[model samples]
Target: MSALPAVIDGRDKRKNPMNIFAQIRELITTTLDTMVQDGTLPDGLNFDPITAEPPRDAAHGDMATNAAMVLAKPAGMKPRDIADALAAKLTSDARITSAEVAGPGFLNLRLAPSVWQAVAKTVLDEGTAFGRGTVGNGLKVNVEYVSANPTGPLHVGHTRGAVFGDALASLLDFAGFDVTREYYINDGGAQVDVLARSVYLRYQEAHGQEVAFPDGTYPGDYLIEVGEALKAKVGDDYLDKGEQYWLEDVRTFATEKMMDLIRSDLKALGVEMDVFYSEKSLYGTGLIEAALKDLKDKGLIYEGVLEPPKGKKPEDWEPREQTLFRSTDHGDDVDRPVMKSDGGWTYFAPDIAYHYDKVQRGFDLLIDVFGADHGGYVKRMKAAVSALSDGKVPLDIKLTQLVKLFKNGEPFKMSKRAGTFVTLRDVVDQVGPDVTRFVMLTRKNDAMLDFDFDKVLEQSRENPVFYVQYAHARVASVLRKAADAGIATDDATLAAADLSLLDHDSELLLLRKLAEWPRLVETAARTNEPHRVAFYLYELAGDFHGLWNKGNEVTSLRFIQEGDPATSQAKIALARATAIVIAAGLGILGVNPAEEMR
Candidate 1:
């Protein structure tokens, strides 16, 4: 990787050089500054609201700016008056071929063909780094995901959160953030006790004793191996021991074994965590006490009685005095109890301590990826972080909706291997990791996604993963064909090609689409959504494929000219640049770009 260029005023100077939209925005701002100095506009007017982006209607122009409309009221002038003045000033630049005012005040500008040609050249120069951005500005971010209890293998619900969180982490890292991927092992909860009992039953069965798994115990066949392993280690030492004699030891052994199973499942899907913080570690340590004490110091902790929850029957409702955190002060709907009347910590207490740990680690931002069932936990968690950090650090929680599995156009059944739910391994094994990852992100994280086993594997345009991968494979084919013809297709040679030969509208449209990549990356990173990358890649692939189909009708639009290697190299450069961006976007999504259809 090349070293990033110098930083100016906390913004990377390279951002403008690689992004044409940013460059044009810079030119618009400079023109506005000149207008201010020339007394055409007021000296103190703010220009931050002005924007330069692609026109909604491509027929209007190549790019559009709302400079005239945004500045009209501030400059105390009519929009058309400002528009005409701005247009005249903008047309003076070499890159701006024409600037026309439309509607009330929008300034639609067409760029010189060389401007689009230069974008293709820049793509060849930067390779995958073309859209890499510094929007994050090196902020430290901690992303916690897949913190499911160590009871069994990760299920499909956990699978969606895992893929979303991992891709978001990679996306943030690509956007220049210092990111830490973490998982919180829920080992201190009652569920682990149930797992211990379940494994004990399996252990008894392993010892040739018939045992029945009660309703509270996990009956998954996945635990049978753990039971056999436990029996092999103990060798009938605790064969008929009482619950007190073996519960603690068996709990420890079972939790570790389940975590190993979870780790293997995650590895099969290509996920690795930087830290696995245990909930058990927060106990018997001063961490929990210290976190609550900080809240007490801030006057956000008190002994109080909360009103009975709404929709509760009067006969079943009781108000008990508890040690509660003043969550309502930080935007929660109500105060939340940290310690119950019996002096035992509630589930919320440990969570507050966990987030407190993240804040103490000096993370500038904290994000939690959770299943949709945890939606109610969002407000209280954010309230805890706000009180803990004194409003210094920010917390964002993303809830991934359920993933419904389909096969042959019907709902898929549960996996017997997992007993009641489908395991992550079950999904990954059916379609492979690349398809699983890409299809998981085809929708917004909060929206319901249907993962159809048959549809995802299809080779049609309806399958987004296949469409995008096919676009990449097509570009690879173009390069091989160019190589067979004895053409120099290296990046250096392509960058030095006579790019003016790429003046066709179809080629320019593709270049314009490529120019939006850096801007798209920054927007997606700011919103912490990696699915936008998936949507953009699909659209880009469509544009590339559309151009390829157009080539069959218009012989001049083909990537390979009959005997004109100069024009051929210019066209191939555009194709290669498109592939470079597709690979970069897929890389962010943790999907490998396909080199061939098979």
Candidate 2:
């Protein structure tokens, strides 16, 4: 007999009722539409400007939207006049208690307390899926990230990009997109040529020859072991046969070893990709020519002379006609070259072809994760995708900034001479993958992260990684305590409890934040920023901590209520929701939610 599938095994499309904020926002939009239909306003109305964002002040209630101000200019009326009419239509909603027209014609929606309570119930009901959003609309997405050069071990800077990209891909997957994580191997560049020469030097040393570092060769000692492995495999066949006999074989062997090191590095960081696309594959397969030809078919590829660069123009400059893509036709600052003067395809050629391949693969959306040094390449890359896809597929590129490592009040410089280059394995071995991944994503991708090796290891409140994990463990501790007291603490029992018994302001605030999970998911997924997930989890943890602190002063606020199993279950329901949301957020960040802190 076949086994029954788990609840999550089946692809069930769960439906959720509109929270008060959503219901009120819908009311405001519908009212504006009705006004247009009645000829009280313009017939064609654009609702993009009407956004129902959470108000900063709690007294203003759940959400606020600018429906009135949006229609004011279009309807040939004052914002206040439009606001009054919109307010009248908005209060008509049963979900919203009062729709007050406030400063600058903004509509402030005051939802009932029951509404916020309902949001908590939604979190409990959906559990980890509570924040799942449908904004992706089942669009296929190809997220290319951590395409680091296969030359050496990954450092802290590479770790940040790896974590960010993995989380971003998971966020898109959870948000209802068919997502594929991809890595583009930079194996066909001059840097790899340098890597080959470096590996050869190491190979000679493996054959017992003394060697000194060259100016352009990779100085890192990683290639030394790779060299030894090659010598063992081929058995001195090319020891004195010169460059022609051994160069290609050594390059291929060295490249594979480097890639193996990189794959191990990514695995240490909990990053796994569905595709590992080789840049060399685009070279001999006529793929680059085809991508360039596709651009030429539309007059985008042409012979052109580039304008002199902004900061420096060589005195020996002579205008050379070369094949360039008309990237300026889209939004690039300048047209870019597809081929160099020597007739070899430039680095950008294979990149354009890779993106073209992605578009051909039926992906509706494309995202690339690059380091901040690639900022100059963003505009041209986006222009290429726009022109190639005919504006059909959208490309969003996220640039991760540098990670500044500090230890003992000094900047930690990883010197290869000291043989102290911190590999991904070194970081994982020191602090484990969960700590490494969490600390890497604690900051915004575009913001510089100060990752102190010492600070991250401290088991204190300042470390957000530990703080958030502690909240989840605290919930588990509460459940254990309740079970010890002979109270039912399972999810089914807790979920079935009457949640209306949870009435404290602190308790309700945590629920309110829990309710925002769905909205936050949609925002993060649409923007392709998973760092927002980490920030949201931190804030949610802050709320949980506040509730825990309140319990110290107010004993009734505790999840365990003496002599009241029903009341205890009700309070535990709120804690369960908190744990579930924390788990969901950690899942997106590729960090495990701790069941108990040890």
By TM-score, who's the top model here? 1
User: Residue 39 of model 1: what lDDT?
Assistant: 88
* 347-384 per-residue lDDT for model 1 (tens digits): 99999999999999999889999999999999999999
The number of clashing residue pairs in each candidate reads 0, 0
Alpha carbon lDDT of residue 528, candidate 1?
A: 84
**lDDT, each prediction:** 0.90, 0.83
lDDT of 2: 0.83
lDDT of 2 at 183: 95
lDDT of 1 at 483: 95
| Whole-structure CA lDDT of model 1 | 0.90
